[model samples]
Target: MATTTHSAARSGGVRLHVQRFGTFLSNMVLPNIGAFIAWGLITALFIETGWITTIGKALGYTGGYGFVEDLGAWGSGSEGTGIVGPMITYLLPLLIGYTGGRMMYNDNLRGGVVGAIATMGAIAGASVPMFLGAMIMGPLGGWSMKKLDALWSHKIRPGFEMLVNNFSAGIWGGFLAVIGFVLAGPLVEAFSTLASKVVNTLVDNGLLPLTSIFIEPAKILFLNNAINQGILTPLGTTEAAQAGQSILFLLEANPGPGLGLLLAFALFGRGAAKASAPGAILIQFVGGIHEIYFPYVLAKPKLIAAVILGGMAGVATNVVFGSGLRSPASPGSIIAVWAASPPGALVGVTASVLVAAGVTFLVAAFLLKLDKSNDDGDLTAATAAMEANKGKKSSVAGTLVGSGAARGNGPIHSIVFACDAGMGSSAMGASVLRKKVHGAGFTDVTVVNKAISSLTDTYDLVVTHEDLTQRAEQRTGSARHVSVNNFMDSPRYDEIVELLQQTNGAAGANGAAAVDGAAVGIPGGRSSGGGDLLSRDSIVLDGRASGRDAAITEAGELLVAAGAVDGSYVPAMHERETSVSTYMGNLLAIPHGTNEAKPAIRRSAISFVRYPQGIDWNGKEVKFVIGVAGAGDDHLKLLGKIAEVFTDSAQVARLEAARTPADVQAVLGAMQPA
Candidate 1:
């Protein structure tokens, strides 16, 4: 990976902190998905749709059904709120409190119990459901109890531990419960009333469509997760409890924009993109993967206008019909939106989506027409010009230029596209990169998509949108991190390929220094210059190693071929594998002989093998195997230096991507032991 730096101005003030708090609240609810689904299903089937009433009538036992027939209230949405109503009213607060507490206390039950008990007070005597109240009291109770437990643990007698724990919890729970009822309840109710008024005002005035203006742009910027999950979902859940539906849920959950964009591409796009667009339509509408179409809009930046117009059309149609959803449409899939819509609102929702798609198609057609000629040209050159223009605007571009030199002599072997959930844009980004890499004839390279939370040091490069750059950097320490503004754009892919080529070229050259002025070349001492430790004949550019044992034997024979070790070294390597596999992560492994097999070493030497297909080292992937042969601490020192080199994911990436023995040797030769 090439060395490039990016800096984003961190927004400050109360608004930023409030957004962070909203993010924290959303994160707490995310882990308790089972609970939300239960609530949503119960509310959707029994209470809102009155499916229970229909079932009762079918069974010929109906009081609710009798009222429906007599009063002509078949779709009144009044099933007396049902069992699920109380569940949302009473049980939901406890669940939120318990989950929030568990989150605060590292998922312990102690905090959960306290949080659940404390939140009951907030719901006491409250006319409406106290979801927001629970959000506050639950975490607070858990945190307070945690602090109290820590204090008592230090002071309490060992024999009285159990007794003290129960009594302390009882006392704290009692006090917090009172505070929740007296102080938190009224405050939360007042805030809820205020928010309801604001929403109602918008709905009444027919100005609710204005929200799409901000929503569409934010969603394109990949703020969809934060906006939908963090802000709207929470608010929608509360509203759904009262109204039996919520337009807030439909705001960001509408997939019309993405669907429209893909429809246009499927009909009008050229080349592979045109072919892929047809498949994307099914994935977006039926499979509920709205992110499948993000790349299409990203290919031509002007298509964002189409997306915005489509989103607004959907929102306006939803508002005009007074259509709302029973729950948030997760994945923003059309099916999910339909399932969540109120009874009799499905027609309106479907029509809105179709209208939005049609409008987007017209707008996208115009945009594509404008760029049709340039679409087949060198996209990389255009991207390069765009990047150079950005550099000119940066305040630190001059300073960055000095540090923007190529890094380690490694090519990118593995690239991981990471996002918040890893399902949406990140997956598409990986697909885009995979196509580009294969087109470049780098078949050995692998590209995978993952959630930011699961990222590790094993990958050579991490590709993330600008919003996630900081988190990606923190997760993948030494791996090269690339930040792009849009995941769907082609230019970023071209830039990555160019960087890989530059690093590959630098690897073959001797005595080169990277951006940090770190010496990167063949590891030296007496090895390459005079000693038998390093030899050109000892390295295999592409080995036919099938498995762990085979890869080690192949590497050991390189030493045998060079006459640096005896036959005993082969079994020694096997014995070492038996005790503990030598697979060091980052797709590289060190197959060294056992410490007791020191006598088998004729002279300190190292042999390298690059497995293009990658060997299954035990259960781990092994792309590079460096067999060690040294006496005393010589091999240990060599192993340490090799660890230093391979640890830079960029270097390993280069080695894995290298096609020839000379290319592989150049990368290995550039390693400077730390």
Candidate 2:
């Protein structure tokens, strides 16, 4: 009978694990669809509107325009366009964050607030330490909120009314969001201004040549006529023709800056420097996506100083000369700048480009040399430590026990060792059993050490010490429980080996075998069917002795001892207690594992801790404690069970007043399973 029960439990666990994997995959992929749609809509709106053309004209372009024709005006267009684009992008992140938070934390308001905070952090974090800042802050903010919620709101709160009223807890979530944006805004503006100043200072020093090369001609073609005259100058009827003529003149200017930018990249860029340089030159010289140089800037930020210095010098030289162009530079070429700007403007643009390039080159070379010299500072010890740690982490096995698998006595393919605390003896026992099993020639079998409460209806067989057998049995109804205090002292090891041999013999004879048996008893005085299992005994003590806190603590420890939870679980419980009391509508408190350490173990057990006096739980007095543990995909099912039982006002009243361990068990036994 025991063998049958164990086999059935193992099969159920395997199914549960597969279902969990499916749910996880769904969560990862489904949310992104909404974000993609939102981005697409914003992009389409930009393409449809004429805002791009108007902004380009305002920025000093003279050619006929349409939305799609002007790429530069997309990001930094008019105030209206700028506002819309960013707002659209912002909505997607906010939605994803809020939805994800609510689902994970079980508090909608807090989740939404956390999501908003994360968005704010991401925005601010993007500016300072560069893109990495955004990546770190977003995830960190989310993680912090999750821990906070788990620690406080779910563990400490007493009643349903109190837990619901504690929604105000989310208000604190906005604090980080506010701080991140405030600090990031000023820093980004400062960096932009500093970048501009660096260019000006280098030009003033005259160490770089003042000859318009790249940007000069592009500036003359685009900025001179439209921004300087068409848009900035009076636009009355009398000035219309002059505006057109000015536009034509700027268009015809020399494209010196375009050439200079190309030359700078060709000379300095590391990868495919020569090839990329000409390509960059051709693109800037004709297509005009100034952002093309951004990658180069990232590869070597110090190069920016030189680029700016060279640009300033080249612009100054072009200004001092009497070079100019008559029309806007369409293809930012030297010919275009000559055609667009008058002689003086042309020379100024040329001079600025040459100066910026030279400054950029020198700064880049110096920085590279300095970096090489400092490369050997302190990395050797760090690398060795990291490699050693990596080896350990990799050696740890993944969760190999699948759900819905039968436990058989046949050559065991897998062994799941469980105990109450998941620490101490259970772990040691598992290691010993695994070695013995290996010695029996079943080398391919996998052995896992876990807390008893975490034992699901999965695994070929579950080997546990005596203390945890009942809890394991209650949790995974069909799992075959092999109660062993010590593998070395017990005859169960030989029994297991004989069972395997018998199954193999059966297979050889009839092509079918009884692979596994139900819960097997050792040939010892102490058996799983012993009469020592605790029964109901009504005893009322000072509520303090058996209060919610005491019960939860004791139950948690028992679970840990049984290998149902980890020893570190107390901290996780405390953290949950801090957020709110987990005690819900009735006498039940659903305490879950908050950290990554015990996320896969989940079991429901009742600890009848009687208190002589009740302890203050939020505003209510509490006596009994019911400890709930569930993790991974079982979270929802566990929560559903709590919700169904506690939602009944009558059921809660009886549970709170229950007197003994058996009485506590009776209350749970009477409740309908969700």
Candidate 3:
């Protein structure tokens, strides 16, 4: 279940770690796929050995004007003149470098300019187009600028900040450009040369079909863009320039396997998967959105074998017929694949796709028929798992009815404002939201700002700039993450405020009359029991722990002895910890049950335990452990007091010095009656 959500626990698996790295590499190029398509179109129709050049000569269109020959960049009249060579050589690599830089800097445009400037050196130094160099320099330039800025971020005077920033970026870019020219260009060029040699070796030895064993599984894991743009596109573009077409483009972009799998599900699958397969087929095959079928394969895990075999057959057929495409076929649509096929290779390309589709359909149909159990794979759970891999919800996943797509498990009472640096934009956003929240008479809701790296699972809602939203979600898996472009004003803020108002209104309507919260065990909401939140007996002065798990268990025991929660809720506390770290900075750690464990609460209570040895908690030191159990909203007040005390380092220091349970209670300013 920990793997089902984005968290530190999820990163424990080696496959998911590789998947995330691949996804990052692909994200830099996926945004600029349109430029690649445009370049492909021009190269296919107008190159010297392309479709137009072959036809124009027979039709006698190549006249004294030299239009056909010029367009094709041949006949010694035009050598480096056509849009094909320059676009592939210059435009594509620059775009990739710029996008990579922006990503590393958290969407700051200054980072992009610096990165592009640095990438120019690598491009000039390399003999080829420098696509690989661009990938290296772009992110490097952006990250360098970020670290440089952090050194003196707030040190500049108010009016001179912009001037310093602009000059600093220019100077830093010039320095990196020199470095990239001297180092990165040759290293990346040599690597790209090696890659080309490897691909040629595989093709010559008839071992190219074996690539499907890795490619098919990677595509299912949503690493298709990484394998295509980050690797195959650059290599294929170079091959196409020398030869008329390259078979590398057809490896991952072959849509036949996905089409066949969906067709099989449409025929033999049960329930929503069967009904959705027909609609998904149109989206996956014609629309060129291969991801539309990933849920189907993931749901039935056995279907992977079918796609792998089908992909192998397609590659083998293409290799045998000497078939290849002029450029990458993105989205892996049947139409794009056909359109990108070389004029002379149409028949062979057609045969390859048909054969792959036929093999996959037969294999998938057999697997579905063999399943005799009433139970089948659940599409909803699979889609959720897919989104977990994606790090965010997919718009395509919504077309399926049973996906259960929702953010955050409980009410949005605690909202966090995060940014690249917590001091600037996030602070402003939190201030604006706090104003709106208090203005609407919902003063109980808490809004605060923090650095992106400092985010914790204690927050129910987290707001960050659009570029930083993915980072925020990676840190706090269960939090409902919201991305807003502007800190001063955003429409999303209004939507959030409205949602809270409507939710509160619904709650008010549901229980118009007075009710007893203590008797019924009010779950995950505020109840009206205002008793003493802490007592002397609830404080433990001599408890010690060796690790995070042991410390959390001890905290849960204190709550259970205080008669705040049931014994079953102890495991729930561990669940919450695994989802995200509960270590609140300032030598403090809060251990509490998950939102689902709210029913186990008998009443609202708070407990404190002091660790003399200071436990090691996920690389952080913790000397104080606070246990929380809230019946309704009563526990929030106690939590708020602790939060306030921790903000002042002096008060925290005083609390840490206390030796007895009574002294600890006095430091907290909460001395409960006996």
Candidate 4:
């Protein structure tokens, strides 16, 4: 028989090992380690006070106990614990949100708000539909601000935009929270139950020896009627309760298990382990929330296994020693447990904690040493090489254009355009350039109109009117720049057209030379009426028509042709209508895409329509109608850029009075790159 290679089997085994290790580290070790430390601090405090005995009596136990009997009474009765407990609980969520948000979005405070909103929304929108809705809306608030900033850089402060965006995001977050509370609570409980069952099975089968210890005690505590009635019952009551209960009942709780988990983390977790572990433990133990130590255990799985083993030992010790606390194991703190239970409960808690801490420390120390040796052998040199490569990649872009000699490569392609609102000139310029490149016609072409910030390094040649050049240059990093004069009549325009002709001519010549019998002549001669280009149905507005009249006519014609609208739309043009227009900052006009109607159009599409003679709009004669159609969320970038171009009052005046399609094109050509 041929010898069979077990490559697949070996790979599967390795993957299984990694997954198991990863799960232990992420789910058990990191989180619980912090919880353990917190528990330790709380337990130590409880040992000092005879609080456990009093707590037992308050819960209906009659035995001699010196501590507080009612868990609820302690807070209303004592101001110190009340303030500390609530404050910690509230701050923990915020801290988590802040940290996560900062990590993801580069420390933007608004991102923290968004993160908080997202977290809260996640909690509230527990139902499937509500969750989906919140997720969808959550990004909108942040995204809208981003869009506005992109559209109107420098004109508006980023901080103000973020504030507005976050405020809106908060409202949506609240809605999401409500949904989550209603839908998620039951689901979370169900999932927790399922998880508990799985954990129990692992313990029963000895598959998870370490975790079994921590979980088993809790399981038994939850099931025991004596512990539940004597401890949990009284603790669960509100301050207004009329309870005649035992005075010295035992709750059967141990703080050491939780504290030991934290010590385990400090021993093995990476970076600031010593510092973070204590803080993590304090929060988890007193707060009764186990999530605090999650990150630590997640940093190292083997360490978590050890911590879990320690927790099991601690819990087992408590159970065997009959050290049960009254008033439940809640608030996980030593003071709360001691004040609420019998003396034996305190002993049980102490013994369990010591055993757990001892086991975790020894196990974690051994693992850390082994891990250090492996890392030293495998990672030191590789890490240094990676750092070097990253540095080189970061500087590549700056190196490309450091010298003057590299700038002389004349732009490979030239583009020309026409638009209704000079406001959209920049957007149209960018869009056409992008489309042309997508068509594979010109890879290194320059796109220019009145707006220039739309230009990117991807372009080599730029041709635009004089007004937008300064702004354009700033964006393009002082790239080879040229200004157009008289629009089409300028020397730059002539040069560009000549370049196009030469390129086409050369291609034609090459094709002719390659084909032996092909005719070396133009296939379609210039037509009589300026050919099909001119004959393609022009909607001419009267030279004396109002801006609204012109806008409505243009919008109707374009929409009807595109099959997006029915019937004529009378444009809503009024006095000062185009004065402080959407073209305020950019050479743009925010004319209605079409008159408002039922069954709205899906997206905004611009229609380029020019007047042979100017019409007055907002005290200025308007010659163009750049129709703007928008719905759903705002496209602030597009609007802001349009406003920027209109900032040049002289350009608007020139555009309104321009004559002929070619002349209109030339005026557009004359507007500088923004």
Say which candidate scores most in TM-score: 3
RMSD of each: 16.8, 20.2, 13.8, 18.4
Over 1-674, each residue of candidate 2 has an lDDT whose tens digit, in order, gives 99999997886565445434434323422444344333333332333233344456568977754435333122464522343234333554455445445445533345545655655654554432222222223334555666665454324433442444345344545665665566643554365346435534544575323333333322322223322222211111111112211221221122333355446545543434334556666555555444344334434445445455445554445434523232224334554444334322434555544554555456555654454332121222322232222222111111111122334433456678775544323334454454445556554556666776566666766777554565566555444568774433357756765655554342233222211111111111121322111123211222323244445565565555544456667556654454334443233344434434455344332223444355555555555444444433222222333333344567556656665554544543454321
The order by descending lDDT is 3, 1, 2, 4
Model 3 misplaced regions, further than 4 Å:
1-12, 54-65, 71-80, 149-175, 374-377, 401-674
Worst 10 residues of 3 by lDDT: 514-523
My TM-score estimates for the predictions, one after another, are 0.53, 0.33, 0.66, 0.30
Score each candidate by Cα lDDT: 0.66, 0.42, 0.74, 0.39
Candidate 4 local Cα displacement, residue 178, angstroms? 15
Off by over 4 Å in 1: 1-8, 11-22, 52-81, 270-275, 295-299, 373-674
Return the clash pairs for model 3, or none.
525-632, 526-632, 526-633, 527-632, 527-633
lDDT of 1 by residue, 200-270 (tens): 89989987877888887655444566677666776787887777778888787787777878777767777
Q: List the residue pairs that clash in candidate 1.
A: 410-654, 411-653, 411-654, 413-653, 521-669, 521-670, 522-669, 522-670
Error of 3 at 17 (Å): 2.8
RMSD of 3: 13.8
| Candidate 4 off by > 4 Å | 1-304, 314-355, 366-670
Candidate with better TM-score, 1 vs 3 = 3
Name the candidate that leads on lDDT: 3
| Cα lDDT, model 4, residue 673 | 26
